[model samples]
Target: MSETIHTGGCQCGAVRFKAHGDEFASSICHCRMCQKQTGGYFGAFATFADNKVEWSRGEVSYFVSSNIAKRGFCKDCGTPLTYEWHGDGVSLAIGAFDDPDKVAPNKQLATKSRIQSFDTLHKLKVREDTYGVEQSCVKLQNFQHPDHDTTTWPKE
Candidate 1:
C-alpha cells in the first residue's frame, strides 16, 4: 500500500502546500502544450487522487489549459504546480515537491512531438550521491515493469 507524502512551494518560499496519499506514477509529457506551459522540453508530473491533496500555505491559481485538463500554479510566483485531468485526477508538477527525488518519471507521454533537445535532457545521468543517501538514486529511465502501461496510469 502507498502511504501519505507531503511537499510544496516556490523558489522564494512564498507559496507552500502539503500533499497527502500514496505516491502515484510519475511521467514526463512531451506534448507541445506542456512544453509551452513549463518553458521546457516537457513537464514532469506525479499523479495523485484529488482528495489526497490539500493546500496548507497558499492558494493555487488554476487555468483550464485544455478541454480535459486544468493547469495550476502558484499565484505569487507563477510556479507551475499541477495538471489535473477532469477524469484522470491530479498530476502534480514534480518540481513543486520538497524532495523531487522521491518520485521518478516512468514514461514519455506525447512522444510524437518531442523535441530534439529532449534527447540531451534524457542523456543527463542522475548521480545517486549527488542529492543524498536518504533519497534514492533511481532514474526514470531505469524503472521497468511487466505491465508497464496498465500499472502506471489511472483509467478514465
Candidate 2:
C-alpha cells in the first residue's frame, strides 16, 4: 500500500482536504440517482477509511442522499464532493482532487446507466461484468466506448 497522500482544493482553492491510507475501492457509478446528483453520466468515487480523512480548508455542506448515506459538496462552488455512509466511511469524488491519477478505479458500478457516448472517447476495450467490475480496463480512456458491455449490471 502507498503512503497517505494529500490533495489540493477545487478551482477557487476554498476546499482542501487530505486522504490518508491507500484508497481501498474506486468506482464509477452510473445509477440514475448518482447521475441526478452529480449532473453527469456517472459518478466516480474513491473510498477511504473515515479516520484517514482530514478536512483542512473548508467545511462541507451535505445532503442526505439516502437513509444511510449523505452526499457532501463544497459550500462555495457546489462541487459534488464526498459521499459518507454511516459506519461505512467516506467516498470522495476523484475529479475534486488536484491529481486523480494517484488512484485507480477498481470497478464500475451501475453500469446499466453508463452513457452511450462514453464508448467513443477512446479505443480501449473493457472487460466488465453486469455488477460493473471491470477486470481489464485501467485508464479513463477505456470509458470512451459508447457501446460498453453492461450485461453484468443489475437491471431496473
Candidate 3:
C-alpha cells in the first residue's frame, strides 16, 4: 500500500487519533468479541504498527478481551476504537476512521461462526430517502464531529 496518514475518532469527537503509516493488512473479523465491540455483523480493521499511531485528543479505555488481546474504545460515547493482539500487532477500527470509504478490507478472519445473513445484508430492504426527511433531521444541530480535522471539538 502507498504511504498515507489516517485520522479519525469517536462519534462525539472526544477521542481523536492519527496513524502515520500505511496499513500492513486490512481484514474483516466475525468473532463474537468483534461483533459485540462493533455492534455490527462484523468488524473491519486495518493493521498498523502500534508505534506509528497516536491519540491526538482524548484517551481510550482498554478492555482486556483476552489474555493476549485488548480492545480500545471511547469512554464517553462507547465508540469502538482499536483491537490489539500481542502477536498480530495493532488493528485500527475501519469504521472509526475519517475517510472510511478509503479503508477496504482485503481479507477476512475468524469466519467459522460468521453471521449467516451478513452476506445477503445488502439485499435487505432499505427505506428510500423521502423529500422532507433530510431537511427535518438537519433542523436540529448535529453534535457529531465533521469528517475532518478540527482545532477544537464539541464546542461548549
Candidate 4:
C-alpha cells in the first residue's frame, strides 16, 4: 500500500516539507513555551517520525528553545514550523500544513496553562458584516504562498 503524503510550508514559500506515512499524534499544546513560539494561545501540531519528513524546498533554521527541545522555523518569514525534543520525533505546526483541517488537534497538553478566554471563545459574535467595508476600502492582494507546492515561488 502507498503511504500518505502531506505537504506544507512557511508563509513566504521559502521553505517546504513533505511528511510521509501516518502521523503519531495531533495535539494542541498550551504550555508557555508553545504560546511564545506560536504567538498565540496554543501551538497545534502533528507529530511524525523524524525519518518520515523531508525538506523539499529551502532549508529551515532552528532555535534551541530549551535544554530539552528546539524549534524550527523559516528565517525569512519567521513562521513556526516544528518542535523537536531531544531524542524524539518532530512535530510540525498544524497551521503550517497545506490543509490544516486535515490534522485537527485530538488532544490538549499542558491544560493548566490554557487561556481562560478559550472556554468562552465560541460565544463571541461573528463579524461577517465587515466584508463589504473591507473589500470596498482596501486593495488587498494576497502575497501568501498558496496552500500547495509550487514549481517556483514569487513568479520571477
Lowest-scoring 10 consecutive residues by lDDT in candidate 4? 128-137
Ranking of all candidate structures by their lDDT, best first: 4, 3, 1, 2
Q: Candidate 3, which ten residues in sequence have the lowest lDDT sum?
A: 17-26
Candidate closest to the true structure, highest TM-score: 4
Cα lDDT tens digits, model 2, 1-156, are 667674744444456678877756788888887788789888888888888788876688899989988888878677788878888678888887667877667788988778888778687778564554454344435312112223222232
- The ten-residue window of minimal lDDT in model 1 covers 144-153
- Candidate 3, residue 31: the lDDT equals 95
- Give Cα-based local distance difference scores for all models: 0.73, 0.72, 0.87, 0.92
Q: What is candidate 3's lDDT per residue for 37-141, written digit by digit as tens?
A: 899988899877877788899898999999989999999999899999887467889988999867789988999969999889999999786989878988988
TM-score of each: 0.71, 0.71, 0.90, 0.94
Model 4 agreement with the true structure over 74-111: per-residue lDDT tens digits = 99999999999977588999999998888788999999
Candidate 1 lDDT, 13-67, residue by residue in tens: 4456666866588899999889988998899988877777776655778889988
Pairs in clash, predicted candidate 3: none
Candidate 4 — which residues are off by over 4 angstroms? 131-138
Q: What's the distance in Å from true for residue 37, model 3?
A: 0.9
